[model samples]
Target: MASGTSQAPEDGGVMPSRAPELLSGNPDVTPDAIRATEKKKVEAPYGQWKSDITKEALFRGSRKLLSPRVCSRTGRTFFTEARPDGIYHLVEASQSGATYSCHTVLPEGYSARSRVYEYGGGADDGKGDDGDAGPRVIFCNFSDCTVQILDVDTEKVTCLLAESDTLRYADFAAPPRPGSPWVLAVQEDHASAVPDQVRNYVVVIHTATGEVRRAVEGADFYMYPSFSADGGKIAWVQWDFPDMPWSGVKLYWADWNDEDGAVSNVEWVAGEDGMTVTEPRWGADGFLYFCYEKTNYRQFYRRRPGGDMALLDLKRYEEAEFGSASMFIGSHTYAILSKECIVAVATENGSDKVIAFNPETLQSQDLSLPLSEITYDGLYRLSDTSFIVIGGGDTTPQAFYLVDITDNDDGARDNRKLTNIRWSIDEVLNPEIFSTPQHIHFSAKSGPKREIHGFYWPPHNLEYKGPEGTKPPLIVQSHGGPTGHTGPGLALSMQYWNARGYATFAINYSGSDGHGKTYRELLNGRWGAIDVNDIAESVRHLSSSTSTPPLIDGRRVGIRGGSAGGYSVLQALCQHPALFAGGACYYGISDVKLLLQETHKMESHYVDFLLFTPGMTDADKEQVMRDRSPVHHAGNITAPLLICHGEDDKVVPISQAYTMYDDIRARGGEVKLVKFPGEGHGFRKGGELAQGA
Candidate 1:
């Protein structure tokens, strides 16, 4: 929904309230004879009456998030797990003080003939009951992954727990242990090879008697479950495979025996003390916490049951890195909501900070604001001083922020601001205003001062004070998790090439993500030689700037991106075809050896760690994926490309931009392609490929 805008919506929306009297075809036609016949067929490009600044004035000095639904102090009748075809309604706080609302959680031909998936609150089912008064649900149904149950005081579905065809990952648990309602599920034993060759476990369901009772297979590979407070026992998470869950993982715990309700001794504790733990939970005197990331920097731990896990900011000059641009740290503990207080989230590399902590005197304050973007979901302790904090970021959107924490965390008890979802971008379009980005560091043609994170914007209404100093055509831009990066924000095609004047830039190079882990493993096996020498050393440091000397037009350079920044914009335009003149590629991937033979199945073995051998040898990974393909050097491409695609893309497949558009039009070059239709691999739909994006 952020694809700049294309205009549609006249009185009832999607253009047509007599289009300004049919563009004055003649009501005696004379709004200066219909703007002199639309300025003789359309040629007002010069300042075109100026003033253009609104999308509420570039979002009113925007730090964004002016409200679009978010409310859950847990009382809106607590319980929702993504719009499962009907039955959703949070409506109650709107008056701009906004709270939350949704209505249809199940009830349209009963959600087009039921069979939903991923429902919630089985919360590691052991079936608790201290104060428990009704309301609890769970769902799953890839037609037959079966395990449904619902009962928000009669919302329906009430039974049927396990019917597994070998279920896969499940949840629910962590409260005051009263044999609390359990339902964990996770199954295996049906291998067809691949997906790390198979071996998975965890079962336990009991949702009030659909019993299956026990099955916690081990020796590595349990699958994220989480519970252990009162629901007797059951805490999950395991890792194995080309390691990802951030390279290392583990965290176990099992005990629940309430007679024969299952679970049994199980162990492991905080990721086997080797580090790299992750989510965990437990708190309120029980002790557990989580998030480790070995030493590559992620922090926060606690443990304590038998005792000795500690680490909370163990000081390397008190280092801290919270969340953003995620390659890890999606959760960092702290959601208690209250006893003294706890609402935490703290990432210093992708810049996030919602703070509040206490966890019994660990003390910290901060509560977000000052360029606000706090995204820390889950935490709902209604009183002892309020709390909600659901999450929102990057110009904020996912709303829900009740906050009180015994007041004076300063945002004046941050009362309510949660518009009931469905958002609007005022039909998007006033973008183009960039300017703040300069972080340069250079020096790595292979060496290593290597700090490369870029930005540079400039170019609207062109002029660094022109009179004969006209330079603007740049573009550069490139980012697609070749481990990911390129931050700061506003990207309406870098504001339509900065409002048609051009000059863009982007960078983040050498395996991005706020520089850590040996500069992100220096792009592991050097992804296309460290992003073509970090975009040719950010265009030779802006053509050797000395206080912005080169406002770019180095002979009109250009290059665009998508997916792995369209494989670093077709390997930086076929490895510098005399420094780019035009490039566009949206669904990028001109053959990493046919992307390791047509990808998917979660990157079928991820080109054996991004380049070769998840089973290589198709003539040595198709000549190293056609020597890092750009349609194998589309006859040394003379630039002017464009490409873009979607036609139901399943991630870079419109046959990899129609095989780089029939190999750059059979090598005559100067491509074009375009496509779009129904859209996927993410362009998001509306029409005419949302008006050509």
Candidate 2:
């Protein structure tokens, strides 16, 4: 409790400044000696102490919960559970008078999963009219991408339509009504061509006849196909290659002929400038609502049926983004709550807020809740007063919750109600095991003094503390997506190191999305080089920190990351060969050109934006790719390295991992390789995850 002492957020961090006698500089009386003399509690080195939060404990009593949605007709909620064994089971929750009962809807062999663009989305939905015919649930079968419907009333799942391995469907949208017979969906046709040439189009499924017809087609990619309140018109998001949805996309709308389930007179609406527009939904007020970053941060925007697009004039939106990228299908952050109000997830500085706003006046208020991060497709409309969402917090894991709200846009406010229905993990460990993340701002030294955002977690454990006169080693984590972000919330990956007595810092570098589009574009044309500089500056900023006693030992440092972050780890080690003790890269990229050529259709041209300018010749672009790729510079890495990869990874092939390992080993650099069988992109099994730990 002393003034200059370092108090861990939850754990007793560094020992209080030694007694005054120890402060009295005496060469023979070392600080460690004085600290031992002044010690009043049991001394144990960090990371070596016994702790209850083991690596295996993360998944012991835990389950991986996917998207959750509520049926507007009957308040029936549906969500999916992903098991380590690879089957994604769909669960439906229905009210039994006063309680909700969750039951798995699929048989043992069927998995409700979508593989559109191979990134996978458009999995399941509990959409239907108020008629008692049955609650119709749309499910995409993982094994063969079949589009099936579950009749919850009879617990019978029947084929709405069947698909082959070459055909996948997702991003399903059903008009809100009483007797709509068809739903619109996006279809990915892989049998049509190779990876980049795969055919993507929008299709309409007629429930009565089980007939499928193409409604929109000939675009590189399509997403968010939506119909107006009366089903008279439709809107969808589209974009071409060399531009991802988060980078450049267009919003389009068309008149729908309900009798024939066909869209006509389709025309480009918004996104003329192509600035990251997505999730277009027509509000009850007859206005199309969506999230667009035209103003540099993806903010709330609404469009009249045939009028201009206008940004919501809310205060908070000036600093916060309404939603994230549309990398995968089936994710939506905002929902129309009523004719006067709409609710959306607003993200600012790595945190989330569910906000309610009026389309006419743009009056908005943050709904008070215990949730932290709301996953994609997390928001669903239950009624004008309530909704369902899946979220996790600092001390809580992910769970499904029913949120009820008073009208915030009606010129008044009241407390919001959040009811937990089911939890991914029910047991809460000792509070001492949690290390609250402290949001910190530092500047990248090599850049033009741009501020860098990150979260710093001090080593924390209920029973252990670092020995006197020493600081915890630092682990600088670079997050994936390069376009993605490391949020300010409870993350097992962030806390895993904290439980072991290591200080950790997660960087949301310049290209990260939560900040704003201006910052998000900072990595364009300078991915590898700029991100490396920012990370290096972060190490210096933390090492030479102005705190009473430095929080981390810069001399004993390591860099860790996965995917895009993994690539950063390798680049950081090579850029500052003498700065780190070692590095861990999980399915990280080693060759830039290989990634550009071999990545999925969604990101095939993403590296083009990252590594080259618009006018660069083919030769110049190739030179830059070679220059920025870490494998080309592996000889510069002096520290030991560990690399892990999934043999089935299509995003970044295992071949990339093999190439990096071979190059490092051939260069006489200390490197190790670990491979997981049947795992792709990310490890799912608890044992494999723990082994990497």
Candidate 3:
């Protein structure tokens, strides 16, 4: 053979070219031929395609962590992170290299959660420094409903109150100074026979001796008990039955005699005549600040020591809500940073923003928040110009950010200084696969000039494209609290559908929160009728719109929701049978009358506002309840329905689902019911969620 040259074939045939040898594949297969074959494989259709956002993704140990609390003594921030194990861990934030490190503060199996009112809050609060011993923390344990103290120095957890399953405590508040040596909490007694007679009061627990004693009583319900900076005064909100906390509440304050350990000179300051008052905070200067809904909106108000209440002037800004309806125990909208400055979270058009206000000057400036949605009770003031908040945008699920407002010029410019220190998930998902929400406003036929709002999210899949010219199926989600508004935050469950080529729409119907008082009250005395109409109208508006993408199929729509939203789902499918292809109801109410009689004490009187008319007789109310119940009108439903209920649910009993299932099946309608054994109103167990998904 010649050096650096090709050799002759052994068979005496012409030698092949060097291209096939370099390619090193089938000799006859050219590069162009291989490329064509791969292209055909990419375009070929197999069976139905699956996505990475599978049921496992939906049931995975992902969580939406919130409630950031920074310790003044240690300068370390602590927050609760909920996980698929159905437990919440008190996490301490630290830094490692360029990444954040989360250290679990609580011991294994010790969940820092409260079951008060079944919506749990006020479970954790930072205790001020005890002399030179650093700051302590008081938290409620879900295991035994006992209040516990976490000693920062020792890293030891000790029960501040003896463990008792019958007695539950939440909404913790520590005195500003260690002289009191006690923590204030709301105590809920579950041993009472009469639901109305259950004892709920503000109590004080001795930090050292673990002794608990009543601090304030004489009210049907008490929540958010807060001590003044001097520890010489205390304030809280109370409400009676036939009225929810959001419907009406009285703000009361009393002079505290710390030496004698008594409350005296108590007086009802505000909240009368079905007015809602919440988040009563005492400023450093002794003025009591709170959110009051006297007008159509819940606005920020401050009352001087002996003067009347006045609204903080925010007329220059667009009309918005300063506070959320008191649905849970620790729902806070604003935090008083100093006597003159306050940081508040407000909602407008289904989005939330942080604002800094000068209570004295009545001047306000919007803080440039990176996220469109701020979690309730997420704002914590670290200083006059700095704070920490838990929020999420269209792509970020939920994360903690240190926000600085020192540069805010009180103008329209983006003055927010933000730094992300921690995330809810360990690994960040691809943002391209997440669907961003588009705010849509549509008019409803039933309400005439009334407009309905919703967040419309189109399907997004970076790797997959649906069959050409085929529209995606639509899923209309009804939020749990008909009073709850669906904000424009990234939701993994919503993204799961979007990634799988399904469009999702979350409706803030007539009765949803965040749209001011008038909108929230739209479902009053017309719950089933108005909510159903608004949901149907939202679907109809999207289906008939010319701007809708061809990828959205008008005729293929489904509805799903839990609790109040589930009720709306069932009602909408029953009333507008031809509008939906299927529906999913989770722990939904099928009988309003039964719900009124058998529901939990916290919501026992909720039906009075939903189904009752002032002048109607008992018979009339009963007839109306029956007429509005989906179980009674199962024959009207034509769409296939799936009903899932927690067997232990007390808010909307499993019986509600059972009755609806039987009624629809007896009517020869398409229906299926699934029950989760150890679940409640909401499924928290990992196995349960996996099974349900």
TM-score, each model? 0.30, 0.90, 0.89
The candidate maximizing lDDT is: 2
Model 3 residue pairs with clashes: 122-171, 471-551, 472-551
Tens digits of per-residue lDDT, candidate 3, 154-181, equal: 7798776777757998888877766567
Worst 10-residue lDDT window, candidate 3 = 11-20
For candidate 2, write residues 492-585 as lDDT tens digits. 6667778778889998888888888888888989999888888888888888855445788888899999999999999999889888999999
In model 2, which range of ten residues has the least summed lDDT?
Answer: 5-14
**lDDT scores for all predictions?**
0.51, 0.77, 0.76
Tens digits of per-residue lDDT for model 1, 436-479: 34445556655666666666766553221222455666788787
